[model samples]
Target: MKTGEKVVLAYSGGLDTSVIIPWLKEKYDCEIIAVCIDVGQGEETHAIKKKAISSGASKVYVEDVVEEFVTDYIYPTLKAGAIYEGKYLLGTSFARPLMAKKLVEIAHQEGANVIAHGCTGKGNDQVRFEVSIKALDPSIKIIAPWRIWEIKSREEEITYALKKGIPISITKEKIYSVDKNIWHISHEGGNLENPWNEPKPELFDMVTPPEKAPDVAEYVSIEFEKGIPVKINGEELSPVELIKKANEIASIYGVGIADIVENRLVGMKSRGVYETPGGTLLYTAHKELESLVLDKETLRFKDIVAQKYADLVYNGLWFSQLKESLDAFVDETQKVVTGVVKLKLYKGNIIIAGLSSPYSLYNEELATFGEDKIYDQKDAEGFINLFGLPLKMRAYQMKHFVENQKYNKTTVGGEQ
Candidate 1:
């Protein structure tokens, strides 16, 4: 609460962050440095900039980290096949850490000792932002307004914003907490909090309803080089462009609409709807390619690793040593994950048409039921005997034990 001290705030032109500019000034009596990282929100940054300054930010920084987000964070997660709780694709999970890291970098650059974010303490993002800041620069102080401020609800925050003369887009009636980026868009709050209520089709932004999707199926080919997506439909594209193209195509077929009521890291359960058209496509294609390239044992083991990796990401441990170690293992497995996967899309389904890789271990000739010179049918006898040896031994012992019990009972009865 020192006057003249500078605090860098992560400002997302939304109601919470827009109100934060005034809140920080009033609470700390410090100069506010509002920073907005462009992770492909598709909204006008110029408007966001003007709004921040008018709301009392001394300076505003709009950083474009879309490419970095896709290549460094999204691709790595996709390659790991990390789907949290078997449903959520972790759209908002990874975005938080990246944004928090940027906040730290900007704080250092601007010579600000304190960093502030608009994340609420009840949610996972608060942890994601704070933990990432701690990992990057432990000395930097974090000011989470939601944890300390008296504003309890969105309605209360709106009232505060109105009283402060701050410009905001949220209304009391149509308030839906949303987070958008290049990868996906997440919708929380509103009627989505109720698990029994199905997500109305109109609630979705990036995807159409499956009932409204095109009648005919669509096919697309995705190419991967060393686990990173490179091309779409035979044309090589940059990471950003590839995802953009995929998003465009998949959205048409109403792909990637997930409604999950997941357990939060803060020991609470929350429901949210995620629209990840491009991310779903990329994840599906990457998995298909890995299935072709990786051996059976390695693929199954990697699945186990994938679950742990999802946990680390969902819990906001991106900059930790364990994450780096897992990344090394994931990267090692992806060395041979080079190939193209063709998929057929109909409504909300992504069906694999074909998959091929130079390092593929699937030998069609050996796997066929017809005669094959490479695989000898006679060799199966020894293989089966060795494989079932323990089971066979146990069965033999049980049979002998039963026979001995019958013989002992007969001998005792005859003697009597």
Candidate 2:
């Protein structure tokens, strides 16, 4: 509704968003509130409030939502076993809706009709942020500066910010856009844009490349409660603390570096180098524990079901029923998926060191190759007989038909 005389913009104090603050101010002629949801983008957030005020924002809110981002968004995706296309952990995809939800809440609180973001038209984030806002509150108009504004490239945005004296951290010499939280740090643009180009040392944030990783292997034991990691190395911790602990541990061993040429929700190809050291270890640990406790059918079906789950979250369908239903099913599976998994982090590879669960179905006696009392040999004969009964009957009918045809031919000759 246009009744609201104010507008709230999701601000990162970056080049795009810094320019967008003033642009929205001039275009809408309304009071602009810059809402910066802090989901753990560290040092860059230092002067965001000061910068937003200087850039013509009437007010600024630098809210800390890091714990909620991890517990609510990140952990649930981990619970549902939703890994985007087997490589991506859905880093940027998961962060957007939480950001948008906060934006809508702030907008309503401030009596604002317009909610805005600096997400580019080329990527999936615009769809994610806008769709979520519409799902939550459709009345608010979305002001996307990237889609509507004349200023095209980051270079131009930086130049504009420099000329206008807007405070920003990025310069032309260092051009990688890094999005960081407890979950991951994704590097895009610059050298990563070319699909074949290998990322240089400086492109990475928290991970050492496999080749340069320590020569010795690092071992870790992670404890889980209903598929959510509860502790690292026998020490209990909260969600944020666990991730923080794992990030430190995994980074040292060169864990969780993904370079992918992925298909965007906008129907374009893009390359991004992602470092999610702790998350990579967590996923492996959870899956290892799951493989032991979860039945063959549930695990197999859930693996396939998770693709849809990933798509829903990746495409911003977190508020939908199907995702909730999948969560219900996934939650049921995780009830018995409680335990510890040991992993060997060597260079880039995460080798399964060991896995143990209270409800593990891996019965050594039942699965052993040698003769075992638990599994009677006579059971197989009955099972094979029952299983092959239909095939045996069909074969008998075909043979009998041919034999009767020969007898009939002999009988016809005798009658003639």
| Whole-model lDDT per candidate | 0.92, 0.87
Kindly state the number of residue pairs that clash in model 1.
0
lDDT by residue for model 1 over 52-78, one digit each (tens)? 999999999999999999988999999
RMSD of each: 1.3, 3.1
Instruction: Provide the global lDDT of candidate 1 against the true structure.
Output: 0.92
Clash pairs of candidate 1? Answer: none
Residue 142 of model 1: what lDDT? 85
Tens digits of per-residue lDDT, candidate 2, 99-191, equal 999999998888787888898999888899999999899988888888888998999989988888887788888888888877899999987
By summed lDDT, the worst window of 10 consecutive residues in model 1 runs over: 20-29
Candidate with the greatest lDDT versus the true structure: 1
